[model samples]
Target: MTRTLSIAIKENIYRELRKLVGVGKISAFANRAIEKGLGELEKEQKREKEQLRQQLIEGYQKRTKNKELQKTLQVYGEIPNERNEYSLSMVGLPLTTDDLKKFLPVEVYIENTPTTGLDKPSKILCDSPFTWNKGIRFKKRLGVVSKEIIEKVKRT
Candidate 1:
């Protein structure tokens, strides 16, 4: 047995119900609409949560990577002080001039201080100067590259 109840609804809602009543029972139509709406809402909420989770994961990964890069640069003496030039002794594993060329798109400017000797250029320069625009544009690509490189290094 089925039970029926008469309930008052807003004018606009009643108008909408009237349209659907021609094709199906008002209760059935309303119940179907409510179920469909809930399903769509559930899907939207799940998508939003997943997006937030991914964003958080990416943010943490980026922060960790930046810290590691800073440490690596420090260990290799690649970090220049007030003086823009890097000492040859400081350029160590993973932080070589070649690595900078391969990884960074910006022009690598090593200001070599003059030494007491023949007037030959002190510093060696690469073929192409690094540019931030190039590197910045390729950030997403470089991020994938860096993650792979870090994982490989970690394993070794």
Candidate 2:
């Protein structure tokens, strides 16, 4: 299905097209060029649209994950630190301030709280299910706190 159409072009461009393709074959050359250019443009547009769609999907997934995290954090409540700073939840993990305080020493928990972005207790110590010291090393300030020092401290 071929339709006749009239269009104007720059004089220099028209002259170059006439010389390169010949005046008699200009229609064929122009038709082929237009088809090739339009195909490339369509392909580029499709790629761009797909990329945008993927980005939107990723963004939606992140928002959904964040909402779930907020709900989980609310269950643990806020933990009060020695410095009076409190954190309702920790990022990247579901561990709460009270959970961290259970295994960590009074002093070591205080030191690591700011670095780990979690809260700690002032003096209270509680029985923790975590018996190993390896899991409590959240930040650079994790050090061995003597049992005597931890026991001597009074609960606040």
Best by lDDT: 2
Model 1 agreement with the true structure over 50-153: per-residue lDDT tens digits: 67656755555565545433222211112222332321122212223344334333223232223212122122232322222111121221111134333433
Q: Which stretches of candidate 1 lie over 4 Å from their true place?
A: 1-8, 66-156
Provide the global lDDT of candidate 2 against the true structure: 0.45
Give lDDT tens digits, candidate 2, residues 62-129. 65534442222221211223422222112221223455435554322333344333344332333221
Candidate with best TM-score: 2
Q: Model 1, poorest ten-residue lDDT window?
A: 134-143
lDDT of each: 0.39, 0.45
Q: Enumerate residue pairs that collide in model 2.
A: none
TM-score for candidate 1, residues paired by index? 0.35
Q: Work out the TM-score per prediction.
A: 0.35, 0.41
Worst 10 residues of 2 by lDDT: 129-138
